[model samples]
Target: MRILLTGSVVATCAFMLFTSGRTLAHDYKLGPLAINHPWSRATPGGSKTGSGYLRVANTGAEPDRLTGGSSPLAERITVHASSTDNEVARMRPVVGGLGLTPGQTVELKPGGAYHLMFEGLRAPLKANDKVPATLTFEKAGSVEVVFDVAAMGAGEGAAKHDGMAPGMHQNGPFQ
Candidate 1:
């Protein structure tokens, strides 16, 4: 009985750590699609928004589309495409969602051209924290995922979070 108790305790501890977003890495799957490295940057207090980034690959012969998703951390999540033109930052909601052709992979990263927007955050996201969210796809339906929070300024060229980690400005870099 004592040995069984110890095993249960250890298992509980590991589960807590992983679920709480303290683990080093995480991954998820929805049928033939592979969801890898879902992540987000910490937000400041009073900020109603945040951002999420990840890579999705469609290994199946059938193509898929990332429509949108939601999270308890925010009012809703939207997939968006952002770009810089002549020193100006421009972002537009992804229309018809993002397409993932067969055997194709796409990365939504900070300071990159694509990303997820978490609007109306319930509260600020602190570094090393994790946010729970979901991704809705046209083909695979929906899958629950966790966003590993980084230090608001993580990665080679992370976004800025003065307010909501918009990482966008009329001028200058999104970094």
Candidate 2:
């Protein structure tokens, strides 16, 4: 009986690892921009919106801006900035676009300053799902990449998911 239980546990663990599409890190390049590890968290049922995160580095002499992006999963994708002021957390759309200067690196991670908001989601994103997206830039034009969906609340600096609705706050993971 003990051996059977152990085997079952092992099998469950394997299943989870297989279901989580976060085992491999992905990267992309457009012009002089290098995007690393573009990913998103799994969304709950009936969620109309979700979030995306990644790291971007500018390796050229000229500066560029991340103008916008697109994905089939959402009708519109926009960049937003999250900040805390007077103990109040707020999120707002970033006007114009996000800029990356020469030799500069910007990270769009959970609990970070910037992120991509997916609005008007057509369907729920499940674990192991890959969401194809195109990131447009002022100088880089655009590049297609796949966003590996991780478990809900599963991301770098992501807090354990507590069943909060999809949104961003200063103190917790993006729900």
Candidate 3:
């Protein structure tokens, strides 16, 4: 029984070691701002276009706005919003910044107000792959976030937190 117990302990340690790094998803920190759960959809290899998502939280006493973003992996990054009107789904550029109130949270998910449009994808993103991006905020400066690729059509139900009602595009960025 001594040998068996030793083996079990070793096995458990190995499992934890392997899985520990897996849970450490990419994160970006800037002063009192933390961007969490950065994720994106895996696109076909060599595809020049893709999308990214994440959640932003401000732990400071002042408000902030996500002005824009950039990445070496893509030609350009733009903030976009998707909406459905008369059964039509449309996307448009968010001219103003995504507003963030002190101690508030904003989620960027699929088919809703928060979206990262990658114009020039350097490499096709595959499921389980990771992508790098630099998020720019008006008050918090810029921070790097690693976006984990999510399965296609996996974020269908993530649009209700910020009043992203069904069938309609969200109205402006959160403040």
lDDT of 1 by residue, 1-175 (tens): 3545588799877666554442223456789987766888888899997888987879799999999899988899998999999999998899989999998888899788889999999899998787888899998999998887888678734322222214332232221
State each model's C-alpha RMSD to the native. Answer: 10.7, 9.2, 8.4
**Model 3: how far is 28 from its true place, Å?**
3.1
| Predictions in order: lDDT | 0.77, 0.78, 0.71
lDDT of 1: 0.77
TM per candidate: 0.75, 0.75, 0.72
Clashing pairs in 1: none
Give the RMSD in angstroms, all C-alphas superposed, for model 1.
Answer: 10.7
Judging by lDDT against the true structure, name the best candidate.
2
lDDT of 2 at 110: 86
lDDT for 148 in candidate 2 is 79
C-alpha lDDT of residue 39 in model 1: 83
Task: List ranges where model 3 is wrong by over 4 Å.
Answer: 1-20, 156-175
Encode model 2's per-residue lDDT on 12-124: one tens digit a residue: 77765663443223556687887766789999999999999987889899999987799988998899999999999899999988999999888888889999998899999
Model 2: lDDT to the true structure: 0.78
Compared with the true structure, model 1 gives a TM-score of: 0.75
